[model samples]
Target: MGMDVYVGPLTRYTLGDWLTVVQQTMQAAGREVRIVHAEPEPEDVITDPVAVSDAVRSWQAGLLSALGSPEGWTDEAELPYWTDKPDWDGYGGMILLAAYDEQPEFRPGTRRGLLRRESRADSARAFQDAPAYKRASSNPTKYPTLLSGVEWWLPVEVAPTVFEAPRVTGQPARMGRVDQLVVELTLLAKRLGLDDDQLGQLRQAGPPDSSTDVEAAGRFGLAVFLELAHAAQLANQPLLLDY
Candidate 1:
């Protein structure tokens, strides 16, 4: 139950179903990697209760279409463990789930990817040089550029957090593996400073993530951490993390 969702660099056109691709890619080369889908949503949350439903449908379609493209960080090198035949350089992408007050609906489910025009464009630029602004300023069409779109609400758990959002509906998301998810989120325990007794209390008490009436608070604590991490990134702040 501890988890945090993050968006990272990816290769051009390597966006759709990347969880499977990354999993299979790592496994084929005998590397252990953790990846998971982090999408948070209330089964029936309506930001504009009247328009919430319509927005949800539209958001879902946008996410699906966005995922079809690819995400990338063309500037960095791949991880040391990367043995995949294809060079992992300049490959980056992002999947945004919801910022929920509860644990994601399930271990495996869809969440939201809140994409504001500014944030979407900002993220996309991380992938490719906005050709027009290149250092050379010569080849305009030589647009060695990356395009960034966004994924909206994906279907998943109906948590209490859903109702708390300024606009309750859907959000952004990510994909990978169950193990990676646990590690990604649990690592924050160091920052959370949970002692043995404190851990117990967190699990037993604290505010729920919004969905399930009751679940250990510690589990959703991780989800909250994940949400905060995303908020930081979208704001252009240091991502407390990105592993």
Candidate 2:
């Protein structure tokens, strides 16, 4: 299967909000939401438009919660981005949180914050350890253009991804600062195999696009990754990857 990778924090909306979105989306597709009621002796397949809508909505809500709610912790199965076979979870062994609507802040007590913190420490340490030390970009000014599509986020208490659908065709969705950082990290981790010294050079060098050396290009991304990690921790957001 082809993989689509997304890096960002969860959205902060309610379960009802997502249910509404599901209904609207279904309606727009000219399909009515439906479910079967299997109680009270006779098992019946529900198709009354309003009843079907309500039944499907209620069912979806249950599914959302059973999976994961931003309001509470979910088993790995409930986590939106989690799969038995994850393509990547190498962010310093931290349990990455995918979006849920209820909780707006990063969950406490995880090593997810280590990457940025380490990057920051490395930045300061490098210069002190060596006068001419190059450092990764601590605070990058811009982000490379992300792919054009509906970006997703976890609404506050919802388990489903909220699509940030573009208003105009071919127009790109804007990513949050932390989201940008997550993407940067994902790319660097996947593409670069630099040592600490190379990373230090990347820190001092500019963004990847400007670099001619192949490794430096990768390092540019690593620099962005470090900055994003710092930003994620500062904002109390999780660095999540969706593949």
> What global local distance difference test value does model 2 have?
0.31
Instruction: Write the residue-wise lDDT of candidate 2 on 1-243 in tens digits.
Output: 211122222221111112222345688999876422122222343434455444434543554455454442211212232111111112111111111001113222213445421221112111222111211112122222122112332223443222232211122333233344455445444444555566557556544342133233334544444554554444444343322
Off by over 4 Å in 2: 1-162, 165-187, 195-197, 208-215, 237-243
Residue by residue across 35-97, what tens digits does model 1's lDDT show?
533444345533333353344335434543544423211211121111111111111111111
Alpha-carbon shift of residue 25 in model 1 (angstroms): 48
Question: TM-scores, in order shown?
Answer: 0.22, 0.26
RMSD to truth, every model = 21.5, 18.6
Minimal lDDT window, size 10, model 2: 92-101
Clashes of each: 39, 15
Q: Evaluate model 1: give its TM-score.
A: 0.22
